[model samples]
Target: MSIWWSLHLRREAASVPLARRLLLGTMETAGVDPDVSYDLSVALSEACANAVEHGGDLHSGGASQAYRVTAYLDGEKCRIEVADSGPGFPAPGPGSAVRRGAVPGAAVPAVTAESGRGLCLIEQLADHVQVSNRPGHGVVVCFDKILKWREGALLRVS
Candidate 1:
């Protein structure tokens, strides 16, 4: 069965875990591999947390002021996207092959900061990760995970 969901959440600290829990529940009910679900949940939490921390304009709930999380599940593969409404990341240099916004495990200049490891953790956990900024609107973080079940499981997707 195909399962999907989308959430529009206030850009607050409390919303981070809420988003994670929703994803976990969705994956569990859909019979996803536990380890894969866990990794995706962690990655989703980090992405949501990043949106809360840097998406900006939390006090206002006006249009284009909240963060969005969307998840899609089809058989053994799951894709999730967390988008925000803010000024967005800086433009990538023309000569650069991949935009900083769409990079995987890209070195963050704010490594010395208290909480700059989200993207790195996501890259380590998710099977695929892509980030892109919407020029003055916001940033979108898209990630995917492929589930693998242990042998002898009752259900396995080819």
Candidate 2:
């Protein structure tokens, strides 16, 4: 069986939890393993939070902008994507840590830093992560995880 959903949400703090809850509920209903669900939820939250915080037009005031979150569960993996309308990431340089669809060897934010840790966390939690920019459009954070099902999952894969 396969399951998928998408949500377009305002870039607000409250929307973060709402998205997380929806993903968690979906995972629960599909009988995904609790730990796997938790990891994905957290990753989702981080991505949502990033979008809410940075996915906006600074000159126009970002609060009024919106972002999108999409989730897909098929075969043995689950994929989630968060796309925001804020200014996309700056063009990467030769030594830049971020690439087209992955952030291999990305640096972790300093302990005292209040931000910049979400991407690393997402990369760590999800089996594969892609952080890309749409130039004058926005940024998209996409990640995928291998799913594990409960013994009697409602949508168990054979």
Q: Which structure among the candidates has the greatest TM-score?
A: 2
Model 2 clash pairs are none
Model 1: CA > 4 A from native = 59-61, 91-101, 104-107, 150-158
Write model 1 residue lDDT over 15-100, tens digit each, in one string: 99999999988766666778988999999999998898879776766745579999988777789999998877655455543415
Candidate 2 lowest-lDDT run of ten: 99-108
Give all TM-scores, in the order shown: 0.82, 0.86
Off by over 4 Å in 2: 58-64, 91-108
**Tens-digit lDDT string for candidate 2 (109-138):** 557988887887888899998877676778
RMSD of candidate 1 to the truth, in angstroms, is: 3.6
